[model samples]
Target: MTQDATAVAAAKVAGVVRELTARVMQYDATRDRRAVFAYTYFRLTSDLAANLRTNTLSFREPEWVADLSVTLAAAYSTAMDAIDSWLGLGAARPDGAPGGEVRAADMPESIPKPWRDVYAASTVRHSYVLEEVLFSMMAHMSYDLPLALRALDPAAHGDLRRHIADFHRMNDLLASSVDGVQDEISARYCRRLHSLDRLFTRDDELFTSYGIRVARGMAWFNCHRLLDPDAAAEAQGSISRSTAAFIAEFRSPDDWKRRHAFRVLRALVPSRRQWPPAGTPPA
Candidate 1:
């Protein structure tokens, strides 16, 4: 799709996800936070993916690019933690589990007042499972960029043709995991996501370890989120640089940070200071 077309599609998908999220949050507010978090998380990441894809300018457009990237990256980090908290993962919980005082029975109290209680229960967990598949599709894309890039002949100098062909196969698999994605998500991408999910589902521990790295890195990123633009620049510069030094067991030197997107695909872990903050939830 053209950049403009891509932006429009992303906006539409985001709106649908948000609307779906609000409805689900009202029914089982407790378990549904996971869906809400994933909804927003995918929105932000999709936004960034769009932004990153619109590299229509020079990297020297550092002022424009860095400012936006830092802010959006911070937003992505926040949404990620929110997702983990909803899932009962990360520093948001005791021992980093998302489980809390809220239980399945406690859902009604956790429900948002803005939504209709009647419609809420109907779509609770199933909606979340649907999002899990969509986000899984997204995570697959965001994470595999590096490896797919490596498979390129390297003659194209980061040209995306080969990468898209290979990575998109995974994208299709992820899309297929969602129930209606065949109608909405591309049929090709949906089929690919389903296939890839099957391949990776059995490798839970490896994925979890990778997720831990991403969460920790994001926590480090979020601690710096409230900083002003210049500071954000310096901070992201440090991160981009650190990502430079952050060797991956997988990735060639030339594409190290670019490939590190897999690590960044997971939720951001919280810094020690952000935990509980004295009166919030107990650790």
Candidate 2:
């Protein structure tokens, strides 16, 4: 399917993700706010640009693309809130102010478990940069996008096939972009020393960590499932339970091998302050 020329024409904007990334990076440079999340956003935007370039740009319908693009940008905005807070530049919790907060704050309740769980995990813990990026993607794509779609049009969608295509196509693009994203992340945050390939991708199914491919597929399934009037409640409950269970593991110290490894890696690297009060904040 050729991309909807009309969507781009009407909005007077293209490459929304690309543009947002650029602006975020420029902010980072200007303020020298090299917060860890900044690099995560960089990977996200770069991967999104790759997705648009190679897979869905020409095929996705403009409306869907616009929705997904805006959804992503909104998620990025919320993330920036956290980043800015960490830099002492601003205060915005992932589940706080910002329109996306409505969708996020209601997670695992009004929305799916993945979104709620991922956000909770990230916020509650001091995680690896990879966890920050991946969990944010998990929550935004898996929850917010679908929830936003339902809100935009509550009518039962007849375009399941198209939705699935777009969803899977984006996933594929992310899978392909993983290596490159990992490279950029490692270079900047991981001391430009250790490679995170094995820790992240692991060469399992679809070239990602074990079960993530299936998890992503499930996220796609849940999107359609959430739109079903009858099934929506049950789906939300199931997602909530599963997400809660996964999050519970983090609460226990025994289940911290992954977190421990990341800590060791980060500690091995020399201390590098990302941001240290650079004059007055930008106006």
Clashing residue pairs in candidate 2 are none
Q: Count the backbone clashes (under 3 Å) in each candidate.
A: 16, 0
Tens digits of per-residue lDDT for model 2 on 1-283?
Answer: 4444544522522455445555545554553222344455456555555454444444455456556656656655655445444435343244333322222354324324464455555543233445545554545545555555555443667455556666566566556666665555555545421333344433223225334456667765776788788889986676556644443443332436766764565456333323324332211
Q: Which stretches in model 1 have alpha-carbon errors above 4 Å?
A: 1-3, 27-203, 206-283
CA lDDT scores, all candidates in order: 0.32, 0.49
Per-residue CA lDDT of model 1 for 153-211, tens digit only, reads 23534333323332333233223333432222223113333443443343222223344
Error of 2 at 275 (Å): 6.6
lDDT of 2: 0.49
